[model samples]
Target: MTTRPPGAAAPATAPPTSGQTPEQAALRPGLKNRHLSMIAIGGVIGAGLFVGSASGIAAAGPGILLSYALVGALVVFVMRMLGEMAAANPSSGSFSAYADRALGRWAGFSIGWLYWFFWVVVLAVEATAGAKILEGWIPAVPQWGWALIVMLVLTITNLASVGSFGEFEFWFAGIKVVAITGFIVLGGLAIFGVLPGSDHAATGFDNLTSHGGFLPNGPGAILTGILLVVFSFMGSEIVTLAAGESPNARQAVAKATRSVIWRVGVFYVGSILVVVSLLPWNDPSIAKKGSYVAALDSIGIPHAGQIMNFIVLTAVLSCLNSGLYTASRMAFSLGQRGDAPRSLVRTNSRGVPQPAILASVAFGFIAVGFNYLWPDTVFQFLLNSSGAVALFVWLVICFSQLRMRGIILRENPEKLVVRMWLFPYLTWATIGMISFVLLYMLTDDSKGGGRVQVLLSVLVAALVVAISLVRERIRRNATQDALASR
Candidate 1:
């Protein structure tokens, strides 16, 4: 069951099969190796890493480094499982397709729609954040106007051609990779007092331990930091999804999964180590300015705040670009699986799923409007409702892979190009860890939004499950009626 590479001439609608439909043939394989490589490299570094880390440091002190390491390891394990299944069978559906085969229609439909909801919400969040920055810089266009403008531009790019989206993401992600890598190099040199003209205030490992010790707030704070920083890692799985559109999807997914370990280690843990070592965790500058900017200032970089603002803006745009692409693909897959409107599976002359793209962006724009109309009440509910969805998606991937691996071995052993480490054991461990995180979210309300997010996400998941079951029942009843009539 090899997937037909995109850009190849799609055959006229084939006779629909019982298990799968015929509409999975139109997406173009316009994503190049460079686009995928940069997306993998830059996906882990998000706007959260730039602007959100200050709070994490304040919570866990220098020990926040350990929180990153813990979460980074969890992501690595999850991606390894996802890569194994993806290498065996790549689809625009990605994990949703696997869940359908391994679990059932309800599992696939529920998870697919949930994942789509997660990204659409992200589209609103990132757009609003980016708009504020653009408005601040230009001051001519208002924030709402900027949000509309940004969404419109990216939507056009996505509808134009898959390659255009790939090219835009290539440069957007490339800027982020360069910024973070430059920060790591410059910050590391400054920590050792080797960078010329660097600020001499508080350099070396002493900064890590000198300020009330490494676990300044206490060992318990690491869990708090974990909750704070884990959401930043949400987009790391985009590489596997993007790989489905590559020419050699199996090889691409395999390569990306293998490389993720070192990338996360270097870009995340290494960068944080430099930040903590270069300046004390309790530094007033870290709280006032972002951690990354404070690190830059410590190294005598002028206009550190303005420089970081540019990088953060780049990150927000990159996220919006990827989020739209992801949501549209999910919608297309769901339609092909008969869980969504069939129209969503239709593609344009350029092999782009124009209907799906528009549908996903329409919801995103609506969310942005709601954000403007009711910033504190209605919009905040929307934000919290989708907050814990990333964890839910990861948990499904873990379960899907577990079932998929056994079926692969029994049915098609040769297709196993990538395999999860420690097979069933680590697979089960990953599931347990994810469940623990969700349960922890339920018990902990101190984050101001944690409990509400978990409860609302559960409520959303339950609603999706109920809808899928009801739809299945209705279809089954209709089929039986036709048979009896015949």
Candidate 2:
């Protein structure tokens, strides 16, 4: 069952076999366009949007918009490249498979395992954050208990079926879209002095200019903002991973890629613009309370702050679910490609990869246990280890696209349903840009804490690469021995 990596032509378009299970049957050539559409919308707008932006705004002040732009543009390029390969041959592995096909087994194995590691860490982080919020509302229950409950609930939902996962994501993304759109619309009205009880004080576009004229942190700050925001958009590409299980994968990838940038731009930059405009960059609330909630309160909206908390909670759960799914599929993909244990590839009757799911969840359970036992040590370790994979993932996407574009055009030119514009020119420029960011993180004062994450993630990436090289050597020797026996 080892299919050629994407960009190779499907072998003569042979008809699919008969007597397949319902999942094997309904698993359409393209994923359900609806499922992918929501995932694309929701994935980028997850916990990062709700929680991470607070720190970015605090670091860069009113000028965080520039940070969102820089990172947003990078994501546009990454997703375009990913879309090109996913459209050619839709697979649950997404970029991991692309790396294997375009690069080599070592590349695929390293990237797949690294990505799996990324999501499992996120699962623990999100559930921990979510549990903290739950404990706020219900002091009777400890945070550990809340974390367990949240994990079990999502685990059941994910194990139900692809359709159930799709349904949950649909509503999850739906709420995010509504919240952002409302923020933009409502915040826009307030900025123009439209709200009935609007204070209309020392705000009104002055914050952008008054505080060192939007570049208060200077041009250098823009790059710092990129470091903050780069992680925010990490989950957007999960849509392609889910595409392999649905009906119209090519179409979904195409539409999702094409529309992804503009959507992210509108939501991320737009919301930041509204927030900074509504409040002073140096406002006490900016540091004590988040920029977004503080701004909403400044505009005379009584409960807007708490209302946002609920939305943030939804965003956290959405990320938790997606992280579990992403890690599971990655492990499954690694197994299928002979990189991981064979048991990980085993699918339940519902087409769920049980071993992979459990393996991914295992870390969350352990991290939760640590939270119950020694909160400080385990929490910092999780934070430190979870830091830099976003950059790594983006770098791999850029490289995979470089190799994939050439192969797709050469092997099956017609299958380029969604082509990246400017070809090798923009693609090469993107590589350089990402390289600069990684180098810059080492010295950037603005990324004081973030540097730790970047460094740790680099260590993880290196370890994965080392393991991949060793594994490949062993595999090669086994292959040679088998051939010698014949």
Candidate 3:
């Protein structure tokens, strides 16, 4: 029923490099389509897939496969909607900007700050995770020391140039893609008794049914499994943000968006299928040894644990790399929009948002120190506090797309290069699904501390919303006062 107001201009189709106005061209076009493509392929494949799937398997048994499929479908739907908006209005702020245009300044300000909080928290969490791997490999440095080193390294990479961040992520994500693809190929061969000299004749589709049927923990566990794996899909939207820096942002976003659903669906569901297929869901080895390593060890892969550890290390670094980049770009966007300090909008000679990068990393370092000193008190609260923010971000995207679609249809239908399937119907379905997930989180208190996490996230979100409203009022008052004086 709603429509774009009269005189509202249709979204422009400016190539990032050839766009008019010196202000628009200030952001360098360092990222190529290949970088965007790789980033998309690799973004969904996180360290959590390798390390965290064990908990989901333990929770849901072989039925965990269904959980992954369900979550993958949800992500595909959400991304389709997000791509439709991002492809039309590419910006460093991404969904935040969309929320601003579609909803209001309040929605955009609250979601932007909350999203930035999520990634900054992620920076600390991932830094600690990478530190553990390094400390395990070479005990020369202590855990805290390793954490500091990893944070510093990635911070430098981001500050050096956006191109540096792109290059680093390209290789990091490449290893993950190759590793997962190899696992799927080799594991499938082993299941079919085609792998040479393999003891995998026992490994087949039977593993899925042999232990307590397909639903070992019953159908309810699938919901629990969803909570476990859903967070792993958080980084999938990084490609949309990276698209803003590309020479051809609209095409880049469209290409990345179109390819992401199939790639992520296959990579996540395919690899998980291989894992549960190779070993029984209740295999003792899976818990004692991590999921991927146990699956590799099942077929007698040499140094499986070491190889998996290296791969996980790469994933952690990739996440940290992209986390810093995403957080800073978001800060830069917020600064430009007046939600954050104006200094954050200033770029170095290389067109790098240095202040934004430093500010984001500074918070990350403080979090690292909290982990070292007061982990149980402060860091634990911080962890649980931001836990459900990914769901919140997804919810905002769903609503933003709903309003954005109406605007695009009325203003310029041609800008909708990537369309959400089924329009408003599926869009509403996705929104309902996300709301169900959040409510599910509130009631579920299995193992991952779901109830406490959701409660804390709610409190944090409320605080941010309040701050945004208060800031808006203050600005409104100031504007009125200025007009009265004039």
**Per-candidate clash tally:** 0, 8, 0
Model 1 scores a C-alpha lDDT of 0.87
The CA lDDT at 165 in model 1 is 87
**lDDT, residue 449, model 3:** 82
**lDDT (Cα, 0-100) at 272 in candidate 1:** 90
Residues 223-271 of candidate 3: C-alpha lDDT, one tens digit per residue = 9999999999999999888887887888887887888768866798889
lDDT winner between candidates 1 and 2: 1
What TM-score against the true fold does each predicted structure earn?
0.95, 0.92, 0.95
By summed lDDT, the worst window of 10 consecutive residues in model 2 runs over: 17-26
Is 2 or 3 the stronger prediction by TM-score?
Answer: 3
lDDT of 2 by residue, 1-486 (tens): 144465655433232222111222323232356777889887889677767777777678777888898788888888898898888877778888888887888889988888887787778778988998999989899887899999999988887776777888888888998998988887888888886677756456877888777877777777777877777787889988888776566777788899988887888989988988877777888677776778788877779768878888899888988888888888887887788898987777766788888888997688767666776676666666667777777888888888988888898799899887798889888888888888877775443366676787778788889999998899899999999999
> Stretches of candidate 3 above 4 Å error?
1-24, 446-448
In model 2, how large is the Cα lDDT of residue 332?
84
Candidate 3 residue 279 C-alpha distance from true site, Å: 0.7
Which prediction has the highest lDDT against the true structure? 3
Q: What's the C-alpha lDDT at position 420 in model 1?
A: 93
Q: What are the RMSD figures for all models against the true structure? A: 3.3, 3.5, 3.2
